[model samples]
Target: MQTPSAADLLLAWERGLDQSPTRRALSLLEACLPGVTLDRLAALPIGMRDTQLLRLRESLFGNSVAAVSECPDCGERLDVAFNTNDVRHMSVEKIDAETMEPQTQAHQLHTGGYDITYRIPTSSDLLVISTADDIEPQLALLQRCLTEVQQNGIPVQANALPDSVIAAISKDMANADPQAQIELGLVCPECSYAWNALFDIAAFLWNEIHAWAKRMLHEVHTLARTYGWREADILAMSARRRQIYLELAQT
Candidate 1:
């Protein structure tokens, strides 16, 4: 079978925006089935899309990414090199089914505090959050989607649930997943300024996609120039063969 082209994979990724991240990632894999799927491209199990995009960026661009940052504490300008290869090659394990199943069970039990009642926010959940008019409504919606049972030990009807209940549910879900927790973790070197840094998956994914898109375009330019090929042709080249050609050209 003819391997699907990189362009094909990219197109698939683009089409996945309307879908949940998990669904989108799953779709990306299906589109490249029998050759390369999104699942195989991911280095970690239950991988964030941003992480997958980092892998794609490293595959297309050399390791070091020029990263620029401004310190909120000291107002100091910081410019440093970020290693894409390190980011891409970072070890990750798949969330075991047993572990995931328990989370579901915990959601059902509602025995834990508000923190333990919510499910992990999925791609689908994010979509609902995005459409909410404000943070309160968004949080309410997230809780509504995640809350499996009410405090009264009754299964909540999703559409009929009260906003207050939804808010409580959201708080509960947030407590359940430490990995999903966002907290501040920065200490300013100069002024010793401390601030909270929110680690949000949505924001991370956006930045990753932005970086990957730029890197892929760069690869298109390089391969097109070296081989006198069209963008489509260059993208079609396997990473191995492309590297071999680059080596031969240098020689």
Candidate 2:
């Protein structure tokens, strides 16, 4: 999918203001990936989905991702900066010819006298589990992804697995899809308390897009008030051109 146009991105941001992060991410992908179905976006593995969002973010904004975290010991805020490529998982996802999207393979694991074949969790899986009542999200995700389970050559349900076995499967899943669980190792300069932080690309990118859309709306309003240009006309103009006009209008 190509980089989304400003108009398309603005619309996506507007529509996503009330949606969940998962739905927002899928919507953003749908806006950018023309001809791709929402079902396909929902089917994307979380890691692959985040990888694509990271690429789009780098293209739209820049290579650097900035985050703020508070120190646990001293309540001091720290600014963490990293390049987009740094957190990207090393696994190379091959593109599917039919859908023009990345194709993911099922992973197999053998642990605690159990054998299992499972696929990575997708957005749809997360969405479905999130709304269900009286269910552990993690366990629900595990159950959804597990395509087949066998214990000592006997088939069994995922929920029947013990905690240790489930933990092992979770660890294996994390290892296989590193991008799905990004933990930033951070040390506070004030207190020297070291900790790990999760950097969610979907939320981060959506925040950026939201901010950009807000700023663009202000610029559009200014230009329209000063020069009477249409909103569509202003957005259709190049970013550089629009900025120039905004400057002139403000002056």
Candidate 3:
């Protein structure tokens, strides 16, 4: 997929405002990756989906992803910066040629006297699970993703699995797909405490896109009022050109 132009990103940002984060992520990818169908993109594993977002994010913004979090112990806020490469788990070999999307391998585990076969959860699974009013979303997700299960050489019901077995499966899934959830080690200078901060790529990228789209809308309004330019014309201009025109309009 080619890099999204300024116009393309602006349109995506506008379209995503009314969408839930899951839907917004799909919209962003659809805008950037026209080659891949929406269904195929939705079927991609969460980690693979995130790998694509990280690529698009790097292209549109930059490699450095900056974030801030409050220290749970001391209540002090900490600034964190990391590169896209840090959390990316999909290697070049797993990328499919036709879709240009990362493909994840199926995993099997023998634990707690049960043989479990599963694949990494996909965006489709996430969308369904998130909409469910479950007390524990992870358990619900595991239930949906459990492709096959056998205990003591006999078929077993996935829902009837015990909490201990579920925990084991969850741990194994996390190890097998590291990129599905990213946790950063954070230190609080004031309290001398350290904690692992969970990072949500979908939320972070959507926040950034929302801010950018608002700023671009303001610029478009200014240019449109001053020079009678269409929104399309304003968005079509390169970022450099738009800034130059904004400066001229201000004068």
Q: Best candidate, TM-score-wise?
A: 2
Model 2 clash pairs are none
**Backbone clash count, each prediction separately:** 8, 0, 0
lDDT measured at residue 210 in model 2 versus the true structure, 0 to 100: 88
Clashes of 3: 0
Off by over 4 Å in 3: 90-93, 101-103, 134-136
Query: What TM-score, computed on C-alpha atoms, does each candidate reach?
Result: 0.53, 0.94, 0.93
* RMSD from true fold, candidate 2: 1.6
Name the candidate, 1 or 3, with the larger TM-score value: 3
Q: What lDDT tens digits, residue by residue, belong to model 2 across residues 146-224? A: 9999988899998899999999999998888898888899999998999998999999999999889989999999999
Q: What are the per-residue Cα lDDT tens digits for candidate 1 across 1-251?
A: 12236676567657766765545554544443435433333322233333444434454444566544457856875544545443332322233321221113335323333222444554445545667766565545555455454545455545555666555655655554444443434566677776655444334444555466567777777767776888777677777887777667667
Task: Give me the candidate number with maximum lDDT.
Answer: 2
Residue 128 lDDT, candidate 3, scale 0-100: 87
Candidate 3 TM-score over all chains jointly: 0.93
**Global Cα lDDT for candidate 1:** 0.50
Minimal lDDT window, size 10, model 1: 96-105
